[model samples]
Target: MSPILLTEDLTMTYHVGKVDVHALRGVNLSVAPGEFVSIMGPSGCGKSTLLHILGGLLKPTSGRVIVDGEDLAAVGDAQRTDIRRRKIGFVFQRFNLFPTLTADGNLRLAEHIHGNHRSKAELAELRREVLGLLGLEKKLHHKPLELSGGEQQRVAIARAVINRPAIILADEPTGNLDSENSEIVLDMLVRLNSQFRQTIVMITHNPEAAAIAERIVEMRDGRIIRESQPDRGAKRG
Candidate 1:
């Protein structure tokens, strides 16, 4: 099987005034269909910028992004969005849930935006399954502010995975949570990855968070500096 995502010499440069912000430089990466990878770096190292590129939110200045065999740069904005909706799921640190909508509503809205329109019944089933899997079944009717931070983040994860997307891109997913809540979310994420075999690429500053992934790629000055596997002994330098 082909990798779900491939990037060769990926580069993103922004010309600000007389200076250039080289966000990414020659980042060659391949994420397999059912793998979890983490990207870690200091601020200004371009980790978030790289996530935007992978998620099709930003175009690389000069590089090839072949996601599920569709080259993003080759397609127009509409097509890139179509592919993003169909193949990708994103979870952010802030949860980014609809404050006014219930958990159930958020997932359904995501379904409506994504591809291969399932029937209303099917969509409902998908929502139910996501809620059940994420342990949010009891809180499906709760609004964002009504739920605890951990619960809200779980709902966000459910919303992301409701479509059963080919890949899940998480950006600083545990950044805002307490230690206990962070562990809970991380455990849930690992469970989901194992159960659904969802390709996951997470950007995080926490070494402990990155250690949960199978492979960790460190970046510096907009370039990949090292790639390593993490054992229990792993710690940031």
Candidate 2:
């Protein structure tokens, strides 16, 4: 089977004022279905840029991003957006939840945006299952402000996975949480990967967070420096 996500000679350059800022320099990566991988790097190392490119949020300057067998660089904006909505899910450092909507409302919005043809009953069932999986079944009526940071992020994760996208791109998902909350979120992510077989590519600076993934990829100066399999038995943050 083809990799769920693949990047070949992925290069991105930004023209800021008079300078050319090179964010990615020929990044080649492949993540098989159900695999969990983390990209670790210092700030300005282009990890975030790579994540965005993989998610179809940004088009790389020169290279190919094949997501679930579709070439992102070859599609027009509308087609790209369609592919992203159907095939990719994203969780960012900031919990981009709607402040006014309840947790359930937020998740329902995602389902609606996904444009699934399920009946109302089926959609409701899916929502229940996802909320239960994320331990948010009882928080359905709570708004973002009413939930703790961890709970809010869990809701965000639930929203991301509600449509069962082929791939998930997480960028510093634990960056804003406290240590205790971070562990909860990370454990939840591990469960999603292990039990649900969700293919994930997460960008993080925390080694402990990286340790939870099946593989860790280190990047420096816009290039992959190394890759290794993490010891699953080791403690993770």
How accurate locally, in lDDT, is each candidate? 0.88, 0.91
What is the Cα-based TM-score of model 1? 0.94
Q: Estimate each model's TM-score.
A: 0.94, 0.96
**Top model number, TM-score:** 2
Score candidate 1 by lDDT.
0.88
**What does candidate 1's lDDT look like per residue over 88-134, in tens digits?**
99999999999999988887678777856688788778777777778
Using alpha carbons, what is the TM-score of model 2?
Answer: 0.96
Clashing pairs in 1: none
Task: For residues 23-134, write the lDDT of model 2, one tens digit per residue.
Answer: 9999999999999999998999999999999999998999999998899988998999999999888998999999999998998899989999888888777777777778
Residue 173 lDDT (model 2): 98
- Cα shift from native, residue 68, model 1 (Å): 0.9
